[model samples]
Target: MNFDNNKLIKIIKFNLCFIITFIPSIMYLHLVEGGQTATELWDSFINLDFYSYYKMIFFLTASFFLLITFLKYVDLNGIKKTNYYLPAAVYSILAVLSSFRAEYKEIVIKGFPDRYENIFVLLGYLLLVVVAVNIVDNKKSFKLILKALFISAFILAIHGILQFYNYDLLATEFGRKLITPDGLDFFVDRLSFVGKKVIYSTMYNPNYVGSYTSMVGILALGLYSSSQKKNKLFISGILSTLLFSFLIGSRSRAGFMGFIAGTVIILYMQRQFLKKHWIRIFVIFTVFTLVFITMNARNLDEIFSDVLFPRTEQEKYLEGEILPPITEVSSEAGKLKLKTTEAEFEIIMASDQIEFLNKQPINVYNSKDEVKEIIFKGKQYLHHSFQINEKENYLIWNYGAKSAQFYYQDGQILMAGMHNNLYPLKKVESIGFKGYERLGSSRAYIWSRTLPLLKDTIFIGHGPDTYAMYFPQDDVIGKLKFFSNPEIIVDKPHNLYLQVAVNTGIISLLALLYLWGNYIFSSFVLYKNSDLSSWKNRLGIALMGAVTAYLVAGFFNDSVISVAPVFWIILGLGISLTILAKGN
Candidate 1:
């Protein structure tokens, strides 16, 4: 009995290591099918999206148990010299605070803060990164990750093929058919109820499929350029077929752009891989070209521009000019007949506006006539603010979707809604700066206003990841989706760097700075330390390329949240970059 107990403990400890290292690869596969491999693994586990709190709890519980089991036999002799405890410690702290960090108020009323769901998820990531780095310890673990990656790619390819054929295999508990996000079972009303859940597309959004393609493209480049020939050729075939699928999956402009930029990076990094196996390179290039030219599934496109078919008249209308980019819509009422200058129109503020007007109605009235009448008779507001203040609310011509009612906190004015192309454009359109005539980034506005808020709370950032709590205070403009309180769920920081800066603070910011800083140093090391045997450089360079692509894509797309699977892949790449601490 004693011997059996000891053996069971040993087995559990070993498997814990396996699970930690393999988790990222599993998560990688989630980007396809249902956007979570664990969800599929534990399909009966939850009632919400895979990235929701229920899934986070499951990961935390499983990880905590494994962690306790592993600590029983600490590999003290194995700790690397270069690995520091600062980053790890910071992550642990953030996770703890994230537990208390109420991103939304009802989340608190509903027990999210009390239970620390977000914190647990954040902590799980910290634990994964910290422990994976410590325990992986060698090239074999790296190979394991690669192998798992191949499996992930295989799963993705299989699903992409199935999605092409319009597959639907499962039925929901609610009697709805279980279909992939972009599967043929789509109904327009799905978005009406699903929130931001993967309702419309097979891979969540077109942007997601774009990132997946870019990631897979990078991974394939690494595999094709590896020292092994058979492995290279095998991945070559799989990746080539998937590349076509990725192109078709590319629905958003940013996704298509990410792929284009990611491909260039892969091309460059692979070009400089510096291996003597020129013959293998030829085979990779030949097979990829031949397969891509011949087969059609691998062509993933993010932008509508890349589609092979001729543009429909409806598409042309949506893409074409409708009206001059609106800067101010000061009552569409004023332009009943159309006038060059301002025209007289009955002025009545909407309910939301009426509430805002009551707060500082005195701020908008200038003359004795407006002021005396208001003060004497007890009224507020006037036609214009010539004598009052220009800083008062003018008008934002919001033609896009309205803000979510009972859900997430909407952040910056520029970074609020789902469709970002139709921004206030109050100033952006005036100079005719171009690029955003269609969809473009509103990050400039998001950052300019939010940075000062962070500067004030530079110490601990409201709490971990609490930008939404403080954003409305600084946002007096009443521009895009400014909620009255903190409970509204606005998840994005819009800018990934700013999100990190606010959630983690200056020290955490420096750790990130060092990580990127190391990328530069590591790139040089990989290039120089790399001669013919530097197979690791293939992945590092591809990752570096993908990171670049993510940054560029992030300017237009939201890649900061866990919902954005690209963020996880990029984090995994950071680990992969210096996996060999003292590189050759």
Candidate 2:
């Protein structure tokens, strides 16, 4: 056994990577109390904790790695020349710098509530990459990391399968208790949320599950392609099938997009291998087809109504018979008029308080104090508990759990906020997809808004994880029109490129692009030149495919902690394998 300090450091690093890759799938739950000045007492208690435990592990791992690397504990010999690391470092630097420019310094530094991709987490990802580049020195280490990834995938796949069958572990007493904090068992009934979707696995969202399986499924195929022994081939092949099934179960179009992109790349790179091994590929494809057809057989109506031909939220809101019919809405000369089937409303701006007039009853709920009951315009109303916040110039009405907000700007009642300087929404700009704002589940609407943000973020951005903070939260009209819910928090740009540009500056985004582009291009060079018979070369190509899938998926999905760490680890390994190819 090699007892040298460098060997020990490398061993420690690999173990850390392995842990980081696998542990996020473990269901660790807790509770987070809302901040001080929460409008509702119920708002203070947030349940279904999934991110914090992994975050603790990530923080500790990153800090430890940084400390050891600074102390020169790694095998300096394993470090090789690569164009990827510098841009990565630049991206990290720009992200940190952007934090200084952020309005919500606390959120920017620690990360936004719930989704914590703070500066420290970003650094953790970067350090993981650094660790991978420096310490993944041999085939044995690479294989071990791959094993860890597959194990994690297996766990997630099984859990997703269970959920799909309505055997959701989280619904069980043990499962409920696992995620719930002590003394919160009485609150479990309240925490037992209704209308929850099936098959989000451990990642919290089905879209994220899609993002995860998309990457792992490709890697599984890579393993299948490279495996020599019958047992190895069978195992990898089954894992691949399960991952694809899991991806299908997630029903994330983004995941499908990523998988397709990766598969195309694999076909192009391994065209010769496919031709020789056509039967193996054929059988796998047939099984994948069967899985898709069988799983979606009962939901064919949804395929037409939701997947193939879907209506936008705006279409649903206007065309559907749900809310009261709105007859007219007009704003002019510092006065707004809104007419509905039930009543007519007039809001006039003044130096002191805005004059509100209505033919029917209008209920006003102030956050400062609760109104028992009020009568306006001769109609009587009972106790109405709602939240209304007053800003310096604007009045914000935050409605429901989705936090749909309505505001008054320039004497006009608007759906979303257009006047708040803290989190401003850019003027509407359409860069293609013009009237098709409903495209990609209203992703077009999100992009329409996100692209305009880039004009200001060319050099410095809003900051890490501050995407939600800067997003026009008050854009209720767009939300209602596009999402059918005015309170929808479009926290992510939904497009990875836009996410980068909007959150961490255009330069940082470009740097990240360069890193990915360089790595993928280098992997291609290696794939074209290297012997496929070699395990390292095969694994290198596999890692390349995995990354390609994630990037394509990124077109529709933002990076989340659950999936990003795995991608970064694979990316780092691909870079390492590229180095090995060069050495060979």
Residue-pair clashes per prediction, in order, are 29, 7
**Per-residue alpha-carbon lDDT of candidate 1 for residues 1-584, written as tens digits (9 for 90 to 100):** 56754664445434443343333222111121222322222232332232233333445565677566446434423344544446556645653453355344333222222122244455555555545455544556556555555565565555544443444222232223332334434442342213332112334344545555555565565556554567666756567457535444343455556656766655555554434556765765576566445534334332334233333323434564322222232223212111112222122333222122222333434464432112111211122221211133122222223221111112212222222222221221112212232223333445555566666445444445345544533232223322322123334455556665665565555665565556545664554444434555655665566555565555455432222333433444456456663454
lDDT of 2: 0.68
TM-score of each: 0.60, 0.79
- Full-model lDDT for every candidate: 0.42, 0.68
Whole-model alpha-carbon lDDT for candidate 1: 0.42
Residue 520 deviation, candidate 2, in Å? 0.7
User: What shift in Å separates residue 432 of candidate 1 from its native position after superposition?
Assistant: 15
- For candidate 1, the per-residue lDDT at 500 reads 56
Model 2 lDDT per residue over 1-584, tens place: 34566566666666655555654565455565544322121233453456544554555565565557535653444455677779989998998888888766666655555566777777777777777787776987887778878887887788787777677777788887886667776554543222354467777677888888989899998778766678988999999999988898888888887898888877777777667777778888999899988776335444334444665444544665224333344456655554444445565543344555543435655455433122344221121122333343333322222232334565444544222222222234546555457767778888887777788899988888778766666555556445756545666888888888888899998999999999999889779655667887778878899999999889888887778878888888888888887888
What TM-score would candidate 1 get against the native? 0.60
Task: Give candidate 2's error at residue 170 in angstroms.
Answer: 2.5
